[model samples]
Target: MSIQSFKFSLQTLRKEGGISQLSYGIRVFIALCGAMALSWGINQIDMVIPLFLGIIASALAETEDGWQGRVRALLITLVLFIITAFGVRLLMPYPWVFGISIALVAFCLSMCGALGRRYGVMAQATLILAVYTMIGLNQATHEMPIWYEPVLLSFGALWYGILSVIWAALFAHVTLRQALTSLYIEIGLYLKLKSKFFPLPTRGAVDSLRLDLAQQHGQVVVALNRVREILVSRIDSNPTNPRLGRYIRFYFIAQGIHERASSSHYNYSDLAETFFHSDILFRLQRQLSEAGTSCRKIGEAIHGGHAIDLRDSEETVAGVLRSIDYLEREAEPTQWRLFRSLRQLTDNVIALQQELDKARQLEDISLSDASQQIPQPRVTFRSILSQIADQLTPKSQVFRHAVRMSLALSCGYAIIQNMNLSVGYWVMLTTLFVCLPTFGSTRKRLYERIAGTVIGLVAAWALITLFPVEVIQLVIAVTAGVVFFLSRNNRYVLATAAITLMVVCCFNQVSDGYDVIWPRLIDTLIGSIISWLAVFFILPDWSHRQLPMTFAEGLRRSADYLRELMRFYQEDNVSEQVYRHSRRRAYNADALLTSTLVSMQQEPGHFRRDTELWQRLVIRSHTLFNYIAAFSAHRGTLIEQPSNQLLADAGNYIVESLQEVAQCLEQKQLVTDSSAEFERLRNTLEDCPSDDDERHYFVQSQLQSLLGQLEEIRRLTLELQVQVHGEHIKDVK
Candidate 1:
């Protein structure tokens, strides 16, 4: 709620670069122009309303999905838009009835978002269409036929859909490349932050570096999620396209590189103490930094459509080799261990370089083998219905948001109806757009909504007064629409300003533009204030209240990921689908927790009493995740399998312990002593086979690390419990 919040938001927005933005801008520009030309110039449609609404749909339907998926989504959206518009127009003559209808429809439409992120976007777009239908109904004046509104709305939606499908068809590969490049760039940035930890001889660097890494890792997860969505959706639709085949292959390679590149295998303190006298630490830092640079260079090559240069990577490897040779005197155990870790790290970097080289030889390899790697799930009607039905509960955030939004919209609608304010649809529009799920988002939207409205109204007034030309104003309105869609996700304030201007300017075609400005500003302010009050007093789902459960979910998911890793190693035949799915779930869960932790920081101070404790929990959770990732990377390279019984016993103990922690967090109970499991795992590790002790030693190190991490997690969770519930746990040494 402070100015710093807005500053941080702006800083985050600044990071989105490259072709994703360009393509979106192009898509929006093309969609708007196409709609305007078809409506205004050729078809002579009714007042460009359908075209404007379709432009809105085009903006909302922006996804990293393939052309086929985009088409599917838009077609569904077109159907929903027609239905919602027609239904609203049919009921508008009855005030009380219309209000009730709005409530019910709003709730149902909002609930559609509960299905998932894709459904959420479509549902939100349909909700906006519903609002637009209401506005259309109010403007009908009883003279126009009911079909007039819905038909025009459907036309605009269809127009945008066609344009989007066409854009995706033409630039499908380009879009895929952009998404991949973005993913790689984000991973590169993550590697850079990770490299900061290599200079761990500096005092107090570990904690700060881990904190920074956690935040950056959260962003990398988001980028990976986007890349996965695009690649998976594409491969699912048609697993035959060579280009898509290549894209998926590269995606898997990037996934591997990300896994190995970002793991903090050796504790920073351990590395620092073991290499304090040697310049090997500095060389290791340089190697990591250069490797990060190479990753970024690969991204640049992808973006620029050129071959990736590996000279820097070669130099880095050579430097790391020379440094390793200089450390030949392995006089101590720690020194040998450090040397091995550095060698493994160098190998990971080399593997990344080799992956990049393979990506460069894209056209030389047949991707027939790659298609078998990804399994596509069959989408069915029964499954869709089941998914929708599953969300029909109070616990789902989407459901609660649905209820909350409907109530807020109803209140706004009632205010507009009672006050009889001119241009009152803006009030409802503002309220609908402002009521997001979390308070932080709602608060941010409110601030941006009010500020953007005032700024937009003033700017539009000046434009209208100066130009006073219908054609000029129309062009400006179209331009504003495109800008609105382009900036909607990142620069909300800019989006609001552009959209407000577009709406006011378009409305001016029916009313005086200058006279409408003040009403628009006043209505926006009123609507924003109402939204603020609603979010504050309504079923406010505070992040702090949700943090404990979220943190527990993070632990559970990380444990699930570890279980999957163990399964991959224990079984001779590994299922890529199972491993990848579990990995994605774990990363997504951690990312969700990380984002929530950030949101909680911006909440009221009273709700953030345990901020420090929450940070520690997040760091520990992330570090635990990194440890599991390391085990996953090393799993494939084991020369001999360790005792499955011992591994199974340790994995079960960890999983059960994680479940216990999750339950305690949710139930707000004090944690019980859990040292017996840890001790047992340690004892099992001690009784390893001496014949293949080297192989067993690797397993021992991994399991011991896992145990140590679990103990730390237990302590952190107990500390959090004490902070939240004032309960003291009995110490068991």
Candidate 2:
């Protein structure tokens, strides 16, 4: 049943009109190949049928584009043909034919860019190649010979359109496979990372990782749908995943625990008070010890390049697998493998701790000096500027887009000018990679482009054979009409398909444009190659890094924000509220960067370093927010029993004061600036230790942890602040 449904879905995509550039380009090839063979039998050839088909097919490319894409394509053709007839002739040799042709084509493409990225690129490529052909052949400045020139160009255009249909089919096939592979990669990475972060077989941590992994899978759905957009409707309109709500709802439970922990208002604990105590310490030591042994084995495995054993990837993957001789029982294979991996991960965590300790020791100098400084005034102008730049065009992305467009068009131009190249028609091939999904590499994109082209050619031929020559013109007309209607909805690819069929019908069925097929095929191949080369070699945006770094930055800032928020909740220190905007700003920026990265991935290849950093920033920021949101709502309140009310109030006091002090040190220096509100919270904690109860026990449980986190925050802040100030600060010890 699933297989049948999947097949049905494929059929839907194939039958559907409106696709993107890649599909459109492929269909163009199909229309040419189909019409040429059909024309061999017909005494009379009219291009009207093929032209109409091409438009309809192109319109279907973008499902929602409605009739806009069809109109856009027509407008582009109309405007360019007019300009080539008038503009190219008058300005030739006077200002140089190259400059005029480039400018004219560039202007036309830029105008059509309103449709979408691929459309603009294709228009420019087509315009340049067509004009170059006319110029290179030294055709008359005035009117063309009615018989051959128009017929040939029209037929060539029709063939190019047919190739697009073939391209669409291939794209649909490849993307399905890619989506599945991506899901497995994400699952593996999640399991591996969790094995390192949570060295124990604790139910809580395991469940947490499981939930997060599920969310990751949901996100992959969005990514997959986005890729599928190449052959279907844009995914932006799709519904959000149902599993997302599960994570959010589950977070409430953790949130209660975190809140209970954060509510210690008068916490004045030192390192000994909240530092690593017996139970948690014992757990850590054991895990680290086990992890070290595991790491050694994993290293050996890595060196040997063998698949390690596994139990269940999501379950407990640690401890020695014991074989019971009496019962004849052994650890399951999955369990054994998982344990092996976890063991190796534990070793790495221990190794990482050594580096952490070294960094901690390096911070001995600035801790004391940071106690005496005051805060800096906030910058109003920069904040205002950031808020106001809503409509600002991203210059780097735009410029690179334009330059790449230039390279593709130039390739088309070179073929027309240099070789009178029949391959000049290949300019249509460049359209396939122009706006590839996933910001993938141009090489990979080109491969897809080539595929779509071949398939579209075949599809167009099959359609032509079924319809035959007699009514093909009618079919072309109807396709044109549909392309016109649907392009308004942004279904450019469908429109392109219709347009391809129409062009082929017009050139072959309506007129003998099939005679020009040989030259057109060469043009198709050349254009595809040149465009791919341009995108592959030219200065590319490091997309992967950008999205990741943005995520990471957001995560780091959110952590700081959460700490401040916790301070406010615990000690009534309202000051932490002032820094709230910092995290918000970081999140907003991260979101924008992520959106861009998602869009760029379709472009092709390795992402730039900064882009990767931005992506990391996004991931980290999301992690921090998710972690905090998962942990608390009231910040310092607890779900468990309390030691005493007095202890509770004290914990609250310390949490606030320390958090404020830490936050202040992040931007300035921390002075002994405890407010009346903070003092009140301290008094409250001092008063609360009457008897053991839920509140009292809760306070007792969280007291030490709160203090430790505060000290850690302060340590981090002092180190950063000192670096900002100077290197001569004296040691605190």
Worst ten-residue run, lDDT, model 2?
319-328
Best candidate, lDDT-wise? 1
Overall lDDT per candidate, in order of appearance: 0.73, 0.39
TM-score of 2: 0.42
Instruction: Kindly list the per-residue Cα lDDT of model 1 for residues 171-257, writing each as its tens digit.
Output: 777767776776776677777677666657365566666777888778878877777667667776665677677777777777887
Error (Å) of candidate 2 at residue 716 is 15
After TM-score superposition, the amount by which residue 470's alpha carbon in candidate 2 deviates from its true location, in angstroms, is 2.9
Off by over 4 Å in 1: 1-19, 34-46, 139-142, 201-203, 329-334, 337-345, 364-368, 637-648, 675-695, 727-733
- Tell me the lDDT of model 1 at 588: 85
Q: How far is 134's C-alpha from truth in model 1 (Å)?
A: 2.5
